[model samples]
Target: MTGWTEYTLALVAFTASHFVPRIGDLRGRLIGRVGRRAYFSVYGLLSLALLVWVIVAAGRAPFVEVWPQAPWMRWAPNLLMPLAAVLIVNGIGIAQPFTLGGRRQAVFDPADPGFAAISRHPLFLALALWSLAHLVPNGDLAHVILFGLFAALALAAIPIFDARAQAHFGPDTAPAFFRATGLFSLAPLANRSWRKRNGGRLVKRTAIGIILWAALLLGHTAVIGVSPLP
Candidate 1:
């Protein structure tokens, strides 16, 4: 198959991998059979593999320029990625069960909602940020298609996840969860109620985010064959 064909297939497979399991009780049935740990391990590996394929295929696809590359384009990812890294650092394995990356065993406290207070779907927001930032620099048909799908999916997932959570938690408990969380907002940082609760964890996560951002910037050329620096 041609590069574009491969890229298309990879994108379809990646999308399906995320959506198919959510159809009816397929995910629950799989978890029942293999146990949650094994099911998620396999699912994670598959998703990672598909994501790498889509990325590589996009590079291989014919570069049809949609817009001229500019030095300013490179600044988008550089500026946004640190925030994305921090969101990933804090959102992963967190107690918020309202969205993706929440730990099943952890209990979510509505009063002290932590990062969820800033965004209930922090990981998805991070994914959207990463996608949009990269999209600004690429300015090519293949990569535009690639990053556009991711950005759209990440944004769309927030409401879908919220609806699902509301359904799962029912009318009583869902109000408190919804009240404490925002879809994506920086106003929480300025708000005294949320500011007092987030405290040390925010600092710790930001430190980790800075380290991760530095590592990614350093490795960008090695991994992607292009320097992220403008």
Candidate 2:
């Protein structure tokens, strides 16, 4: 239970930072007053700061072994994080009205839904993947609690966000949007039609994802005090 108080407080603060902004029209009103870029920038910094506190506090907390360290476990994040990074890079600043990264651009044609056709909630999926991947290597109780909640929350947010999208677009329009995209479908990736339309953009984003993955992998030990290498 050592340092548990700080860990718990940091976790609560981090969680509240996200949900508080979205309560009723708080986020909308904040954006109205402070502009979208400023609002997100401040929110992002606050979230990042709280996240760092949570991680540091977890490190200071009592270590209770849930599973013994295995050389093989380290490979999970190494293998999965690149895909997660790809999802993250592609998901950011997209025009998919059905997901978190939507509201950035003004245009989103359900007909040519781009990446949304493959996964409507790529960012959420990426978060789930990243958290789960880390959980494989981090078998301590504190790390488990930290990453487990993150994995659960990210997975839960997908359907919640989708429902919010439906509410926003209304019954008449939501069905068509749902028909055009999928929550977790990979069919679009294999489809010739989607490939013809979004292949170039996908390739470009994948390259960026690879670069991001490399940067994180190289920076992990310096930033987090552990190498991600298996």
Candidate 3:
């Protein structure tokens, strides 16, 4: 198959793996039939396979440069990646867990929102920032498409999930959960409530994030064959 064709299939599989199971009664049906553990096992492996395929195919695809390599822009990834990692850790918890185990947000009171007051969809922000961080530095056609698709998906998921939440939890409830939250700055940093609420957690998270960032910095060359540190 052609590089474009392989890339297209990889992209489709990645997107479908995320959506097809959750959007409809499909997830329930599978769980009922196979049991949640088995279903999750199958689903997890499939998703991982598709993700690996995407990475491999994207790397192998025709490298048409979209922009001249600017090593100066390497700083962007360094900054953005750590921030992205932090957001990812914070995002997939409390109200919005990304994994199958934390799928149900019903037990968790949405009213308290916690970190979600920063952004209704921190995972989306993480994914988008992660994509953009790499997208800018890579400067190749396949990578541009790969990261661009992910960023677009991340952006699209915000409103889509919001609308779904409204439909699931009633119109008033969804809006209420997001009262102080936003896509970016629905909750301003200057707000005393925001500062008071997130302060301690932010400090702890920063410590963890720095460790993660350092590992990434040191591992970048070994993993991606590129040096991200200055």
Q: What is the Cα root-mean-square deviation between model 2 and the actual structure?
A: 2.0
Q: Which tens-of-lDDT digit does each residue in 115-207 have in candidate 2?
A: 888788889999999999999889999999999999999999888988887897799888888898887777887889899999999999999
- Candidate with more favorable, higher lDDT: 2 or 3: 2
Candidate 3 has its poorest 10 consecutive residues by lDDT at 98-107
lDDT by residue (1-230, candidate 3, tens digit) is: 99889988899889888888877789999899999789878988998899879988998788899987787877778878888877766665545442222345334355455666666677678889989988888889999888999889888877777776667658666656556455666345576765687778866876787787788788878876767865
- Which is the leading candidate under TM-score? 1
* lDDT of the candidates, in the order given: 0.90, 0.88, 0.74
Q: Give the clashing pairs for model 2.
A: none
Give a tens-digit lDDT track for model 1, residues 1-230.
99889988999899999889989989999999999999999999999999999999999998899998899999999999999999999888877876889887767788887888877888999999999999999999999999999999999988888898889779999999888888777877887877777767888888998899999999999999999998
Cα displacement (Å) at residue 89, model 2: 0.6
The list of candidate 1 runs beyond 4 A from truth reads 187-197
Of 2 and 3, the candidate ranking higher by TM-score: 2
